[model samples]
Target: MDMGRYLFRQVRGSDAAAIYELAVANEYHSDNLPLNRSLIKAYVQRSVKDFAIISSSGVCKNPLYMFVLEDTYTRTVVGVSQIKNILWRLLYQLRLDPFLGENIGKLALKKEDGTWELGGLLLSKEVRGGKLGKLLSYGRLAYLMSKGLAPRMLISGFLKNTFWEYIAIRIGVSKEYNPDKHWRSFKTLTKFMGLLPAHILLAETGIAFGYFEDLFKIPIPIKPESEPARKLLVDMGLCFLKEIEANGILWHGAPWKVIRDDNFMRYKVPQDTIEVDTCKTSCHLDIGMAVLPSDDFRAQYIPVAKLEDGRVYISKKDFSCGKPKHLFIFETKNV
Candidate 1:
């Protein structure tokens, strides 16, 4: 989809080079977006295949969609957004009462239908402002709801390194935290524990666990880079699920129905042309993303739209090529 000087489309194999460059440039802050060339290429290939399969059969064993935003002026990719099946894992959160040192409870991972994760949003520093980031982020949901691929539940992870920071403090070292430090400490701690008898070790489990009891007490510093993404997730209706925390980062989750209702997920095809209002005047016009339902999906910003008879009316110029089967319509805030 064309957004003036920018374009949004599904990732193609040809975009591997541009995406690799984008990843390398943002390596310092890269979350899910990898910096490896081969890994990025494989992701592009899988994304292309997954999109094709889902468009055709409406099913894929491992679904993953990677969307790219390109600068039309330079014909180079500038931003990326990703959607993938949620990775389910079984793990326990070791907690101890700060005062009494008692175990709270262990949690087992559960699976649910229609669950997906929205993350891996990265943009070039040059195109960091404006609504470009929102377009790349929300446009993925627009496409999913348009194609009936919307997840029943959506999850998002923020503050990538905050988990490691928590671990650093638990190890009694903050600034000097690394793999070497962790490995050395792990060896020393295990060897010391090995010397204790089974009964003694079992009895001291509470004391051993108490070392990390300060997990929740410490204030986590939110990274400046992840603040915007977190805000977008909150705006999308996701809330913190206190039960889950991976790598020190708390995951946010919400039902798809909640997001759908909050975003006004009513969709329709434009029967006739309507004037595209830029909302520059005092008059108010709702902004949303218009997605073309086709094998080659394309989505762009729609500044003004009229919802009537459960059908959306948009500017004829937006669909100059031909009439589309469906247009994904959603209400957006602050553009």
Candidate 2:
């Protein structure tokens, strides 16, 4: 999607310095994406290698991508988003639902194949509005589609709040500010917690003290500030699964096709690509994005020539890698 003065693309090696500057200047720094220069460089290097491997072989063991939203004219990196593949065992759990009664369901990992996590999504305070957040968040998905590597499930986790802080202390694992370590402990706690069979008798007492163990992955309360993020995911076709996989974090997931279809209803894509000699027509406000095919994975919001014969046309010069075949053109909206 076009932000007019901004451009979004995968992280390049030269972006490490700017990324570090952006991270340090931001008031709220995420542990998953630290404010260290060396770390930022490592992330950029890894993303470049990962992109190359995926482009050539069409698969990778560590399928990770780091994307940046840059100020086009200024050439400054103002925002960043990361995508990585992760695996979790599809375990079962018993939940005591107030209205639904006791129900046994698979822990909310969503799919047996694996899951793709959207994390480390951060934007500068100055550029927070006008659907830029949605651009950074959903651009990761667009990148996945460009590579034809959409996972079976997609997820994002929030930070732990005070309510969870108290519960964590009682559970013997104090709230760790680091999200990575906190999530690791949460996973370990769920394993043996399921063995205890006294949930029914100890339910009320557990609630009174705020240390109720469900003998499974405990559901963490969604913090107030994270509500908007959660709502966006829900709007994108994800549901709040009962199984909380991390501390103070609410996890949401659904089949990839569900999200793809939901987004399709909003961001309609052109069925085919039309290469033209020159982009001689006015800009199409409704058309917002053009994505190259798998061999040359790139997405940008460039001017498109007016529709002719019911086909969307773009100039050959729109892409730097020469003429692309079957590029996906997405319609633009507030979403």
Candidate 3:
């Protein structure tokens, strides 16, 4: 298929059915999540609201973009790539604690610095072949850069499997943090106390009480079939940052610039082309801002921009609070 005519556009309300079908297909293929049409509808609605928030804030001077690869010939949508400014919120909502909480703590401690994240890249099975995956992946990077959010790193979490591990190794970046290993020592206590209320236990122990067992990875025989995908990620310059077996998964980090240079911007958003649209979707919203407990909590706010000259800006500020700043996390397994 000639991909030239297939432009990537922001998903519209009319795309609910297509998006729902895609979610169903993915869930069926991966055994990842149960397919519920109402849930998928909610997800699409949330995406629309997030876009509106970005536009109204004028934070990046562009709406937080979610692109759906459209077959101009058939007018069918094929894939999706989205850039979320506050992706940690998504991780938190999913109750993907420890993994997201650890990172949020790191971010709080480093409040003087600036960082952005790219997330949620899902492509249809038919389009997973060839350079299209790479195109959609990097295509998102290009779009973010244009929005003035040139993120230093692109973070992703992959399931613990030989195929994925092998891919990280090939990419020349591999680290192991077994969530299971970390949780083994605490399992007995957790199991014994599992019946007690979490708040009561925390009060008694002076330590937060939460079961971390479900996050650990179970060792399974690797099928002979799963190595190629791992190889591809390694070849693309992604590396394993750490292994959190206690959480049943591994955390990987990839540098965005390594995939493509600044020049890749031309392929996604053209210069001097400002397109705007209205999004009137209803969804839940939560905002979290926190200051670190460390000294010198002076917040550093920097502007994000697409132009080399820095035409767009996002401001960050520090605020005083009774407890540590609240961190928002978002996660959805019920697709």
Candidate 4:
């Protein structure tokens, strides 16, 4: 169980086949997206490009990084964890429209005021016994902290289950179940119905239960056995933010003093590092607080700053003046 034998590194194009095979084998549990060779290839390519940009620009704000746990003996990837720049993309593409599209961005903007989300933690079935999950989870957070992007608050969503909730409670991140909670009642009703045979439930409600079931199939069952992992997360300081039916999301925050502590400062900023690439040309000034430059654009890491006029400025080294392009300012924070 020497975890050090498995190192984390940016995934490469050559890894497409291995990743695709892994995804295909685990599709029944992990991803519902259609399994196709072409699509998988495209995903790998996009991920590679994204890692390149983040590595080159020294930007840690984007959740586009895919760190793989490699088996040194076999030279294979055994586990993967992901952080996202934006969490609502999958929800949006599905057209499920949980909340209005505009509101989604607004909510993210609001959340960014003090928090960031940590999600998409998955590991191969073979690698489940050790403390690899914990290591990977903390590793991602550590990476974020190094970029000066650690958010005060960190959040994660979990499907409803006693095991997971118990874990959250143990970590002091979740509250004891309260019958008065609105979401609790909703979840109880949903689970009750979910227990019935699918056809029976569909017949009773006259709702296309299969469609919804297929669409939102729970990859992992909410069993009591998974409480250990849940407890571990809560202990690390995450709490329940909101719950939808049988699902709930949690939040955690690092104390202000802890964030400014000397140990944290040294852990976050690196002294020796590669120089960041700068813009090749001058850019036009825009009437915006910050610009949401495309991930394709080449730019240096810019610290976010507040202006005297009550506007925020994402300090960029150069304003690309070539095209009369408009850039939307995206909220910046580390997850």
Which tens-of-lDDT digit does each residue in 1-335 have in candidate 3?
44344545555667767866776676432211114566545656666765555545555422345556666678887766555443221111122246445221110111212234343455677766534555445555544543445566654443433433443344344443222332234543233223222211001111111212222322333232223433444555656543332222333446567644533322222323311222111111211112223322111111112233422211232222222321211111121
**Candidate 4, after superposition: displacement of residue 243 in Å?**
2.9
Candidate 1, which ten residues in sequence have the lowest lDDT sum? Answer: 200-209
lDDT (0 to 1) per candidate: 0.61, 0.61, 0.39, 0.41
lDDT of 2 at 88: 58
Better of 1 and 4 by TM-score: 1
Backbone clash tally (model 1)? 1
Off by over 4 Å in 4: 27-43, 58-62, 87-115, 159-221, 224-226, 245-335
The candidate with the higher lDDT, 2 or 4, is 2
Worst 10 residues of 3 by lDDT: 200-209
Q: Across residues 1-335, which tens digit of lDDT does each residue of candidate 2 receive?
A: 34655666788888888888888888555545766688778878988899888867667876779998878888888888888887653333337668756543333443345687788888888887555676677778777776778787887765544534555555565633434444446455454334324332112221111224455445444344456666777778886555544334435678889888765435544555454555432444434455545344445555554454555555555545444433433543222
Candidate with maximal TM-score: 1
What is the model-wide C-alpha lDDT for candidate 3? 0.39
Q: Against the hidden reference, what TM-scores do the models get?
A: 0.71, 0.68, 0.46, 0.46
The CA-based lDDT of model 1 is what? 0.61
Which residue pairs in candidate 2 collide?
194-215
Per-residue alpha-carbon lDDT of model 1 for 1-335, expressed as tens digits? 23546767899989988888887787633335656678788888999999888777668866889999978688899998898886563223334556765544244445546778887788888777667788888778777766777677888765335445555555555656543233225443333323322210001221111112333444344566666777777777887654423333446789888887665354333446433433332232455455655567666664444545443344444444344444544453333
Q: How many residue pairs clash in each candidate?
A: 1, 1, 34, 15
Query: Where in model 1 is the C-alpha error above 4 Å?
Result: 1-3, 28-31, 90-113, 169-218, 264-287, 302-335
Q: Higher TM-score: candidate 1 or 2?
A: 1
lDDT of 4: 0.41
Better of 3 and 4 by lDDT: 4
Query: What is every candidate's alpha-carbon RMSD to the true fold?
Result: 7.8, 6.8, 18.7, 17.5
